[model samples]
Target chain A: MLATTIHGPRDIRVEEVPDPTIKRPTDAIVRVVAGCVCGSDLWPYRGENPIQAGATIGHECIGVVEEVGGDVQQFRPGDFVIVPFCHCDNTCAHCEAGVQSACDNLSMTTSGQGELARVGQADGSLVAVDGGAPDAALVPSLLALTDVMPTGWHAAVSAGVAKGGSVVVVGDGAVGLCGVLAASVMGAETIIAMSRHEDRQRLATDFGATHVVAERDRAGAKAVKEITGGVGADAVLECVGTDQSMGTAFAVARPGATVGFVGVPHGVELPVGKMFQKNVALRGGIAPVRRYLPELLELVLDGRIDPGRVFDLTLPLADAPEAYRAMDERRAIKVLLQP
Target chain B: MLATTIHGPRDIRVEEVPDPTIKRPTDAIVRVVAGCVCGSDLWPYRGENPIQAGATIGHECIGVVEEVGGDVQQFRPGDFVIVPFCHCDNTCAHCEAGVQSACDNLSMTTSGQGELARVGQADGSLVAVDGGAPDAALVPSLLALTDVMPTGWHAAVSAGVAKGGSVVVVGDGAVGLCGVLAASVMGAETIIAMSRHEDRQRLATDFGATHVVAERDRAGAKAVKEITGGVGADAVLECVGTDQSMGTAFAVARPGATVGFVGVPHGVELPVGKMFQKNVALRGGIAPVRRYLPELLELVLDGRIDPGRVFDLTLPLADAPEAYRAMDERRAIKVLLQP
Candidate 1:
């Protein structure tokens, strides 16, 4: 089996690795049909996040179950399913509360960049696509149901983006673009997407952004406020975890609004006094992808949302390094890999 | 008019000051029937929060409306009303959203320690008691409605404490004691009060704390966890603004729980990483006292709750200095001042 592995910074390679097999009573072996490179992978590729010498890469996938353990009653061989980025028992208190990402028995189950992967807690982590797999043209959209789409949905819901409400989305990555789509789906009347790049801005506009602010920092916040009649938006979605992005999210929210953030925080320190004075509620964390898979998959299947358009580049598994470079260089909004 | 003023740290004095009058079209003058010393006032009295010399003290009061400006339509002379600690223009977007404390035109209408105090934005700041003024015995409870009661209610409501849910109330001050009462009113099944002092613990228990954990910091959190079967409480109301108290509040909440805080943040810095990993949502700020006054007032008038019992000591207006000293020395849970 061919898999993606990282040797060091900017050192991604496709190498032959042992095929996965069910090793636990709650495990299932998956033959990945489609995988993708994430913006987060750039963290270690850029050396901002350290990586082991030969760590297997990729965490998002859609595939067919090749084999299932005895305890995995919900899934069996030959079934097409979406593998959530995180594995959980789904019966713990946190999982029952819809925060499966914080499940008591939680593990990052990333091996999607490979030809085959082992999924633990299979009964709880696998969401089978209704019927069988869809046409090849719908694979990217189905794959998105694994992570980015749900993450974007989480940001919107956390920020309390209500029907006919206004939302300002900070960041133009695939997740941010999806957030704009999610906010629109949630019935937000005004969707503002912040982007500095032409291509990303176009995608944002197409994905239901009513307005776009290309400015950065305080100026960007000023732009958002100006567009919203100086009162700011009803909700601000922080999709970029940088300090600047966080600052803008708070600044562009009305005094009583909330900032929903799903970005992986890096070097961000919230000013307690400032947040308190504005009465802004910030709520978001890693998305419970499994919890949202059913509805999102239905939406994708019904063609209500085309989040799959985020994949601007697709390549064979052997070109894994090039896929990473395309996304790392901003040449692709997101890259889909065929295994 | 005799009023309480701070000349410097530890220098509370009841001195003759100019009487307040309607200064704006939205203002009203109220003759205070009862006023109380707040834990926050001691912040400057103890020299922790700096104070300017000759600053009027005390912000909580219930009084008879003596005069109203032409624009003050909701309140009029002779009406017995609760003066919300924070004055706001109810027409602002924030006020419309029920976060009156964050209103665009906001002011802290203090001078409650004096015989007469000016209420700004009178229409938005006053909630009249039904059926006119009640017996003099209810003065203390009416006074509680001004700040502490609403503040505690804010903590409970912000934390999303629901019926059949468990809550952990941090801090044992007047606000914290009131929080216990608020949680009970909200139908929280298990209310755990964290207090180190016997007097406060007694007040907590009386306020409907089903369990009292007389431990601080880590031990207190441990006790709460042990009591909740190691799953932690469904909500945590942080009534103390200190870093330790904030930490404990998060420590005692289960994943996907919300931590509502009303204490003026003193030295609190949230660790974003820890909160994110646990999926804990922190939401709270200065209590929108005006928004809550009506419901809390009805509760008090109905004798369903007795928050005024928190004022264990009462003194004449001339003894204002002693009132401050008693609270500073922890000789009283709360103190009341009468003119």
Candidate 2:
């Protein structure tokens, strides 16, 4: 079996590892078909985040059930599935409240953790598609539904972007580009994408961004304000998870508008007083991807949306190091690794 | 007519001024039935806020219409009315959105401004009661409706406090105490009032606060978490508008809960990042007093609620300066000035 391993900062290698085997009743052994490097992945690949040696790094994957545990009833061998980033028990009060990311029995990825680990609640964590087996072309998009697509959907949906609302997306990574499509499919009258690079901006436009502003929060907020007759945008998706992006989201939203954020926040905080005075609603977190996967996949299957445009570089699993550097240097919006 | 004027910080005086006259078509001259010292008023009176010479010092008032201009058709020679701290035209888009304080035609009290100043959109700003005159027993309560009562209601309502929810209040001033009553009426099951004084705590308990925590934000947050199974309070009402009070409100509310703030913010800047991560909502501002005046008047008129409990001291209108001193020195929770 093959797997991607990180030895140190900026060092990734494809190595032979033991084949995955179901160890728990609630587990499923799947052969990774397509996995993508996330922007969040850069934090650890850059060694800014703590990582252990010889760890299997990818969390975003679309695979097939090679084998199912005794307790696994819904998923079966040979079924194509999308795996959410977080594993949850799915029966807790928090899960009932639709905050699956904050579920009581939640499992986050850790280095050295085996591939065939119990999904905690297998039926709830994996969503099987109706199609027999996803084609090579659909693999990237299906795998995207696991994290980025639903996360983008969550940003648009949580910010309450509906028909005829104006939406501004901050960040130009996979999630931000996907957000443009999400807002467009959600019926937003205007979609603004803030990006610097021409390639990402072009895809953002392809993804249904009505306007593109190269400026960051302050200048971006000004541009959006001017575009909206100085009232600011109706909904803003802060996908960068930085102080600047969050500030721009708050600034560009009109009084009584909302800003949805899905980026794993690093140093961002909310201005409680200003939000109160302006009646701005701030909502978003680690997305409950499973909650929105079914709808998102339907959109993908129906050809109403295409999120795979986010993948700029696809490579064999051996090129994980190049994939990490390309993403860190902004050479690629998203990279797909085939295993 | 006699009025309290602030010539300088700490130099408020009771002075005789010429009687007011109707100067505009929509203007009405009122003989003040009663006026009181607000905690916000203490800001300028104590020299913390700059005051121009001879500025009219009182904003919270109940008055009888001594005369009406030719265009004033609602009231004639004698009608008791509650005067909101904010004078709004009520015709602008902001006012139409129920934020009368942000109305385009809003007027602020200025030094040496005649009492016969126009009340724009008088129809919407003034709520007419059935009787030409109000009962003496309801005078204090009616005055409370003009600012503190409605302001407090705005806090709880904006905070999204509901029946059987837990609440924590951050101030022990008149508005804070009034918020306890408001939360109680809203059926908050657990109301925690943070007060250092025994008398104000007693009044808070009488006003419906079930628990009293004498700490500010950090400790208060811990106290609330200790009480609510480590989940924090369901809602927090910020009655003080300082950095500490704002931080406390954020700390006390659990994730996804709302914090209502009605205090006249003095030197408060909100922490935007922490709030966004915790998923707490920040709501409320200078309350739109006109929105709740009608309902509050009905409650007071029916004797179902009494807001006068906020006023623990009474003084003649001639002693307004002394009343201001008493409140500034923290000697009086609130002082009622009888004319």
Candidate 3:
């Protein structure tokens, strides 16, 4: 099977690898029908995140079950499914509490960015696609339900975005664009997207962003304040995990508002005193993708949201290197790979 | 007028001070009938929080309105009220959102711990006690409503303590004991109080703690886990703002749980990575005392909760120095001062 592997910074390659097999009673072997590059992948590609030698990358996929261990009861061979980023037994207290992302028996199986990957805790990790294999046109959107879309939804829900409320999105990546769409779906009245790039800004608008502020730093926060008449947004979605993005999110939120974040944090220190003074609540972390899959899948199936538009570029799995390069160079909002 | 003043570290004195008079149209001069030393007061008393020479001290007070400026409409002379720690206009967006503690025209009126304290934003800062001034026996209870009781309620509410949920109180101080009471009032089925002191433990039990874990640090969290059958508490109220208490609060909370904190944070840094991985949310800051005053006051008046029991010692205004010393030496749970 062909799999994506990284040897060092900017050294992604698609190479022949041994096919995966179900190694545990709770495991299932998946033939990935589709996979996509993630914003988080850029961390290691840019050398911002340390990488191990010959590590398989990527963590999002939609696939068909090829084989399942005897103990797997929820899925069977040829079953189309969305494999959430995190593998969990799904019966633990955490999983029961709708936070399977923090499942105690958690195993990360999506790191094997290959044509065939072994998924652990199959019963809990795999969400069978409704009505079997989706049409080719719906594949990208269905695949998105695996992570990005749910992540965006988590950001909105965590921020407590509600009907007639306002939200400010603090990144323009695919996740940020999805956040705009998610906030809209959640009934937010005003969705503000912060993007400096013209293309990303346009996509943000199409995704339901009512305003776009191209300025960075204090100026950007100032723009949000101005747009909201100096009251700031009701909720701020911090899709980027930089200190600057966190700062901007906090700066543009009105007193008593909340900032929900989903990007993996890096060097982020919450100014407790400032947060305390403003009574702003900072609430968000990893999105429990599995928790919202059912609702989000329904929305996607019903055509209520078109989050798949985030994938501006698509290529064969063999062009994995080009996909990474395009996203890293900002040439693609997100790249979809066909296996 | 007699007032409490801090001349230096560990140096408290009750001496003659100029009588407070209305300086703003929105101000009301309250003759403090009851005042109390707070856990936060120990910061400056022990020199942890620096104090200017001869700085007026004290923040918790229940008093009778002696005079009101022309613009004050909420109260007239002879009205008894609870003066929350913070003074705010109560009409700002933040106030309207039930976070009056973060009101735009916020004022720290508690600094002048004098008999005649002129309160700014009187209409918004004072919650008139139902009926007239109560008997002397109810003085301490009314004073508790000013800060400690509401602070505890904030911790429980911010942590989202729902009916039948479990909560862990991280400190055994008056605030922690009050948190135990607050959680019980909020309908928690399991309230775990973490305390090593016998008096506090007994008080915690009296305040409705279903369980008491006397251990500290990791062992403390382990005890909580044991109590919940390997799952942590559903809500953890952080009443001590130290790093150790913060760590314990986070450790004792299950994934998807929240830690509501009200202690003035000192040397506390939230480990974002750890919190992120666990899906634990940190949600509390300064309690908006004004927001919960009405409901809490009703609870007190209806005899549903007795938070004033936390004041184990009472002292006359002239003995203010003794009150500070008792709290600093841990010889008293709290000290009430009568002016």
How well does each candidate superpose onto the true structure, as a TM-score? 0.98, 0.84, 0.98
Model 2: DockQ vs. true structure:
0.31
Which pairs of residues have clashing backbones in candidate 2?
A268-B273, A269-B272, A269-B273, A269-B274, A270-B271, A270-B272, A270-B273, A271-B272, B217-B248
Please, what are the lDDT tens digits per residue for candidate 2 over residues B41-143? Answer: 8788777787778767677777766777777777766676777777776666667667777666665432111232224445456666577677777777887
Under CAPRI classification, how is model 2 graded? acceptable
Candidate number of the best lDDT: 1
- Ten-residue region with minimum lDDT total, candidate 1 chain A: A103-112
Relative to the true structure, how large is the alpha-carbon lDDT of every model?
0.90, 0.77, 0.88
Model 1 C-alpha lDDT per residue in residues B1-339, reported as the tens digit of each score: 999999889999999888887779999999998988999998899889988899789998888999999998887789988899999888888898888988888988679898999999988878888667788888888889999999999999989999999999999999999999999999999999998899999989989999999888888888999999889999999998999999999899888888998888898988787777777888889889988887888898889999999999999989999999999999998999999
Q: For candidate 2, lDDT tens digit of each residue in A1-339?
A: 667778888877777766656666877666567787888888778787787887777778777777888888898988877778776667765566566776666764321112332244677688887776777788778878868888898889778898988899998899998889999998999998999999999999999998999987577778988887766787889898777778888888876677888887766656655776676767777777777877888888988888987998998777777888899999888998776
Q: What is the full ranking by TM-score, best candidate first? A: 3, 1, 2
What is the per-residue lDDT of model 3 for residues A1-339, given as tens digits with 9 covering 90 to 100? 889999899999898867777789999988898899999899899899898868787788888899999999989999999888888888888899998888887877554468987888999888897678889999889878878899899989888999999999999999999999999998899999999999999989998999999998899999999999778889999999998999999999888888998988989898777777776777788888888988998999899998899998999998999999999999999999988
TM-score for predicted model 3 compared with the true structure = 0.98
Docking class of 3: medium
- For residue A315, give model 2's deviation from the true position in Å: 2.4
Ranking according to DockQ, highest score first: 1, 3, 2
Best-matching candidate per DockQ: 1
